[model samples]
Target: MTAHPDRTAEGVWDLTVATPIGRIKAVVEFRRRDGALTGVASGAGEDVPLRDIAVDGTLVTWKQSVTKPLRLNLAFAVDVRGDTLEGTSRAGRLPASKVTGTRRTTPARTAE
Candidate 1:
């Protein structure tokens, strides 16, 4: 079997969005397993577990939920380009919020 190379979205990313309440921040990390994608979105006083993660080319989608301040579940659809990610997070029937951020570069790995 042939192994594919890593993509731009397969690393820790620092994301932010401006909302009516205030500017929110989240750290998202993604990884691929057996042709499937999985990740976590954490911030805003809570850590959220992502679900239904899917990746296609430069596009990625996932679902995350929070239960603090309120019970809310968000669906994310983002396009990864270079070191930037831009997209929206939809909550039910409400309008999607603007989501944008830059990818965080990780330190070089050392041989064991």
Candidate 2:
């Protein structure tokens, strides 16, 4: 059976990227479409669409742009294992930075 969005890897990810300056926390969300992935990655108050999204086995790759800190694009490839995501992020042609994140848990809805 296909996994539901509520209980699958195709949901919100709270990620942190390790840079020479410091660690930056970001948020991303993934949705599976026809066995492929499409989503938005948010950083520095900008929500950019995930481009060139590719999935192989348990690994996924995507890219987005950052406008606040500077004008640069980031490419990310991550391996999803259980509830943890391990991966690297690349900014332009610079060396890749370590990226890690965990799936965010949704609280149960309370009926009013």
Candidate 3:
């Protein structure tokens, strides 16, 4: 079988959100496993786990749970181009907020 490109390359994502309070920034680190994406978000002094990552061509979608007494679910979509990623995020709740971000290169390995 032909070898697929390694998806486990770690990368950094810089996100901007337009909230009622104001615009907020979030930096997320993502890693891939067998073509599935997984990562963590660094926001509000916490590292939150990411899930439900899907990649279709240049489009990517994933869910991030923001649980700090109050549970908030955030869904994101990004477009991958070359070594960069650009996308938007929205809340699972009604009247969703819009978020945008960029992904940059990080460290990578051959295997986990």
Computed on alpha carbons, the lDDT of every model, listed in order, comes to 0.76, 0.80, 0.68
Candidate 2 lDDT score at position 31: 78
Name the runs in model 2 displaced over 4 angstroms. 1-8, 33-35, 107-112
Q: Number of clashing residue pairs in every model?
A: 0, 0, 0
Worst 10 residues of 3 by lDDT: 1-10
lDDT of model 3, residue 33? 61
Index of the highest-TM-score prediction = 2
Tens-digit lDDT string for candidate 1 (1-112)? 3223345477788988655565678888877778666677778677677898876777778898877555778888888887898999887887788889888777323479
TM-score of 2: 0.82
Clash count in backbone of candidate 1: 0
C-alpha-based local distance difference test score of model 2? 0.80
Score every model by TM-score: 0.80, 0.82, 0.69
- State the displacement of the C-alpha of residue 84, model 3, in Å, after optimal TM-score superposition: 4.8
RMSD of each: 4.4, 4.0, 5.2
Q: Order the candidates by lDDT, highest first.
A: 2, 1, 3
Over 53-111, each residue of candidate 2 has an lDDT whose tens digit, in order, gives: 77666777888888867787889999887678999999988999999999877722247
lDDT comparing candidate 3 with the true structure: 0.68
